[model samples]
Target: MEEEPCSLVYRLEQKYLNDDDAYMDQDIVLTNFTGSSPCKMASKRALELVVLNNANISHLGDVSQVSGLMQHVAEADLAWNSIRWECVKSVLKHLPQLRTLNLSYNPLDGEIAVDLPSAPLLHTLILNGTNLSLTSLSSILKNTPCLQELHLSDNKLDFSDDDESVMNESVKTIHMNRCRIEDWAQVVRLMRRFPNRKTVFLCENPIKSIVHQTPVEDLSTLQSLNLGKVELIFQEFSQKKLIQIYNIIDFLDRSFNDTTLEAQVNH
Candidate 1:
């Protein structure tokens, strides 16, 4: 069992944070706060990290019903619940200091293009398993300009059209594993647009086969690219009876480079 946070020992508000300082008033957890609104308690205590996840809450208005814990909150885990985009925007109104939000595992497929709250402090957003598209995604990016890390894995993402992802330079890491994207041009567009993208996860996407064919001319900023599962990709081709294995050697030879490539050079 987890040690019940060693009781809040009232220490004089001092400059140096030592072992004597109690961790009690630091976090307010109500994962099982089933029939009660915990934000009132959070507001009363001015908690820093509020975890209301798995609380069977339909809308974030439950928190708005009771006031208080808005100014001090830095992290919120509202994942694994029935939350919509509007509810999240309402959450931003109270949690301006919020940096990380976990909205994963929720079926928020209907919400689209809802205006984001003005929270410059917000940096990370976890939207895993949410059926997202270009239109809904653009709406979110339009509202939040300072997002640095975005997670949109396990969704149906197809950027075959000429739609450009409205991602800011602040965003450096993108996780899109198993998104089913088949367009290499869309992937190239993302790489060209984001000047600071250090890590990109495109594994298990349909666009893997085209990587060898597509000239990655604009991926100078990319440091880590997870395009593994070569066996799976080849097996997928075999299962579909699309191409013969004899072309595999040709594919490898064309993608290999004898000289170190410049960031701007064509592959």
Candidate 2:
């Protein structure tokens, strides 16, 4: 029989029994400590809310250490780290109860493809500043059916003609600002497909023009349309085209102000 470390023993005792218990009722725990020791200790206790903010944690430690702790965790923010896709997948496997995941500012590159073992209860997934491609995006959407809000702003999402079907009806809001998306027809197709989408951010894209010839049937579902800085280049204009854009804008304005649209979906 060997005695456990002083810190581990103390943490175990406090986790099981303590008034205003640190481990049991802990909402957030942020530390900059790196290496396996701190992670191993932190993963031992059950926490409903946790924040490993600004940590140097890069790799996946022992998976068994973080098994049951996921059910109790509601929110976890591991932003501004050096974690990659493999580490992210390992961490996500334990977080069955996670609702919000912020992986912004990580040094992740190449395609972003992940297949979770179970459907994540995740609603918001922030991938800002990660090098993600259309293939990665498709993979994520195909796997995470419950994902609502996705942030891919400031990444390289160059969409070809073949990637049109990736933007389906499941996603609510998508931020693709500064991604240099030049195809307006593809954008129109996406909007038409996802009539129930809440917001579509297309800022800073080289969109020459938006020829909205098709009559929009369900504009009541669209909330925000960020086309700022898009070069709307119209070659041959028609009366129908002008009216269509105007109608779309009007619907967007109404949807943005109306709170009912937000209540329509439970993501």
Candidate 3:
């Protein structure tokens, strides 16, 4: 049998790190590594973050080697790879401390043949550009009992009709940018599914107009909603009303102070 080469290497780019005190404690990053051997850094006890984006990983077995090094990792980025849901399931098995995981731009097609492993501490999951279906998403939600945020940008998620989903109270924020959603009713229905939703990102979606004039009844907990290129802030008065403000400005304007109200509706 051919030996798998050790491709995991410790890396730290100051530009990517933020000013968080949690990161100050023995932060270790392994990025842009090749092959399947992430165990090379197993001796590093303080390994907290891992970045394996675009690492040519195609098989499910490629990520099993990450178990040893990712035992203590809290964050991981495996974007732009050809890995599927099985590979993600394999990676999650060892990350007991994982809080945030990014698997964007991968071919993680629904494949719900088996339930994903439990990730009790995982709160944020980014599957942007992964083409995950609603059924697959519901399947994933069953195990991530504590997930709070879901990012699904660049997927073909058009909630134009009723679809069954697992009700998860833990999800507070959902990002569906560029998801080709056009119906407001469908959007409201999707939002109602996550009873605890606080924020929604619908930028770049094809929703040109709000067909439903009634304010979302179930989303009383929602605080912010992003639509198109502008942001819509929901504030309640004596009579509740949904306000949408549009501001147009020159792309070169450094000041970015130009503003214009395209339209407003009082309900």
Candidate 4:
């Protein structure tokens, strides 16, 4: 006979609320949890990170469960769950101090329209592999007034020619890796949309050749840009005009090397 599945409340208590060793760690991670029961962990104000990834959770059945436990959570990872856009709004309502939220791989494609609650403190939001649309992206920008970093990688984003420009002043970094962006002009439009963007990753897109042919003026003011698999044609541009782009490429190279070195050192 198979052993019984642990309740979410019991698992949380065993790992965080009751464990003496976990007292120093202010994280509550319950991945692959199938229990439908509400997490009744007594309010733990000290907790900062709450990860419920791949839990098959559609919604927080009890709002009190969220309010009492995740009120002060700074980062929440609810990735690979069955959560909708409305549920995200509810989570934001309770998690007032949430600085980073990972809602990647959630089934949000069915949401025709949504109005997210104001998340003034939210800075980073990951929506990778969520099958998002421009309409949903617009709603996200409207609510996350102070958002600085956005991850929309692995999604099929089809921006039409007639779409009006969407601007958000606070957004400084964006990750659009593997987004299948085919047009160089579309890339320029994206940059314009996020006027204050300092860092942008458009890796694995089909606009590599177009990037080299585009005017340098179209790509100025960017501090860091990752064009993965997009090689630069150094012979086509003058050294003075290409210096900024060269610096960005050098930065990406150095960042990769540093990360590799750190991993090697740890190993």
Error of 4 at 60 (Å): 1.7
Give me candidate 4's TM-score against the actual structure.
0.70
User: Candidate 2: global Cα-lDDT?
Assistant: 0.59
Q: TM per model?
A: 0.67, 0.63, 0.69, 0.70
Model 2, span 135-188: residue lDDT tens? 665665565667888788787655554645645456798877776666666666
Residue lDDT tens for model 3, 56-119: 5654444343445556778988788767776667667767889999989988776667657999
lDDT (Cα atoms) of all candidates against the true structure: 0.58, 0.59, 0.64, 0.66
Cα RMSD (Å) per model?
A: 10.3, 10.0, 10.8, 8.8
RMSD of 3: 10.8
- Residue 95 CA displacement from its true place in model 4, Å: 0.7
> Across residues 112-165, which tens digit of lDDT does each residue of candidate 4 receive?
355678899999999999987877777777888899999999998877745657
Candidate 2 residue 124 C-alpha distance from true site, Å: 1.0
Highest lDDT: which candidate?
4
Candidate 1, position 110, lDDT: 75
Runs off by more than 4 Å, candidate 1: 1-43, 62-66, 111-113, 206-208, 212-217, 236-267
Question: Considering only N, C-alpha and C atoms within 3 Å, which residue pairs clash in candidate 1?
Answer: 43-68, 43-69
Compared to the true structure, candidate 1 yields what TM-score?
0.67
lDDT of 3 at 137: 81
TM-score ranking from best to worst? 4, 3, 1, 2
